[model samples]
Target: MRATRLNLMRAFAALVIVTLLAGCGFKLRGSNGSYRMPFHTIFLGVPDTSALGTELKRNLRAADDVVVLDKAEGADVQLVVISETRGRQILSLNNLGRVREYLLTYTFNFRVMDAKGAELLPATEITLKRSMEFNEQEVLAKEAEANLLYRDMQSDLVQQILRRLAAMKAPAPQASVPAK
Candidate 1:
């Protein structure tokens, strides 16, 4: 009886913890794409062939009731990619002078503008970084690992941008012109 009671208590504790987390709006990274983009139609400035552009489109597709267009024509808003830059620096060196660690950084600058060219979001920058240890014997593996870290940072950047878009109030309705 005591063992059963202890198990029940543990389960109840876990349930309470989950509830609290939900109430506080805590979510796992990239687990949920529940944000709704304010714009009904959006045109991404980045080229479709780019990896970052592809991921951004994929995530934006999950936004409720939003249309992502292949062409800028007929789009209600445009998302401009100001710039994207990556950097790597030696974080540390081994006793023998080989690279022991590297600091990886991905910087993204972007903004949102309406069809009328009014800024919904001024230029904003989000930088993500990850530090990884290097192994001389695993050059190939380390390169692959570094690529993975960069991808992870890209995903993070997308999420942050999505959140910002969702937080903004929907753009003021544009006045429609009467047919001539």
Candidate 2:
């Protein structure tokens, strides 16, 4: 009887906490990366093999079943990726002139526009960089670590994109001028 009472109390407490959080308008957008976009239909111009693209697509699906159009003809917004670049540079050298630290960079440029090409979100560039210490003794391990860091950056970029979409305002309706 005591154990049952304890379990019931715990459940009640959890329910109260969830209700309070909801009342406070606190939403946790983590892991699932769900967002509320201003537009309903969107066309994303990205390849299937792209990690960021895949993550973005998943998030969009979670966002109220947003329409992912293959063509931009009927989309409310068309996302265009201008460029994606990855680079590495030597940051420091050891006493023997060997590399000690390296900087890895990821740059992404994108824009959102209507089917007629009016800009919704102008061209925005997001760049991420991480400094890695290298050791000749652990070449394979260091390579793996670099790959992990890059993957982490890709995930961050996806979340950033989602936040931007969530914050975007709906496009203003165009008014036609009467012919002279």
Candidate 3:
């Protein structure tokens, strides 16, 4: 009878503690959730890089859990690309007038910012490309080539963005010294 009464008291105490904790709004987020920054809301400002901006927004939407916004209105971060350059080159050719080993390059500036629009990752350029045989006979095939190249470029851009996000690190925790 004593043990049962003690157990009941313990259970009542535990319930009271849980109720107090719940009233205080203490939430037990997951492990990964603890490290997550308040980065859910984002604003994208691309200037003349509108096309690339659209592609970036799509990639961020599909690959990241961020919510993109227009301008900096009610956002946690801002992503921007300042400039971009695109070029193409031919790497191979056949004796029968067939061209092969074409390469495409795209260089661009990127930046991440806080809600106040302060730069987090300073302006930087990332370049990516794709190369393939150039066929002059089939225009439809050339169109396919362009599509592939664009896809590669988008993939590369997405990788670069994710890399930046992963590279973010919080400040190191301070150590406490024990007095001898």
Best by lDDT: 2
- Candidate 1 residue 139 Cα shift, in angstroms, is 0.2
How large is the C-alpha RMSD of every model relative to the true structure?
3.8, 5.9, 16.0
Q: Which has the greatest TM-score? A: 1
Alpha carbon lDDT at 1, candidate 3: 100
Stretches off by above 4 angstroms in model 2 are 1-32, 172-180
Stretches of candidate 1 above 4 Å error? 1-31
lDDT at position 61, candidate 1? 84
For all predicted structures, in order, the TM-scores are 0.83, 0.78, 0.59
What ranking emerges by lDDT with the best candidate at the front? 2, 1, 3
Q: Which digits, one per residue and each the tens of the lDDT, describe model 3 over residues 65-162? A: 67778767677677776877777888888887667567888787777777655667788788887776676777698878877787678667766666
Cα lDDT of all candidates, in order?
A: 0.88, 0.88, 0.70
Worst 10 residues of 1 by lDDT: 29-38
Tens-digit lDDT string for candidate 1 (102-148):
99999999998887888988999998989999998999999999999
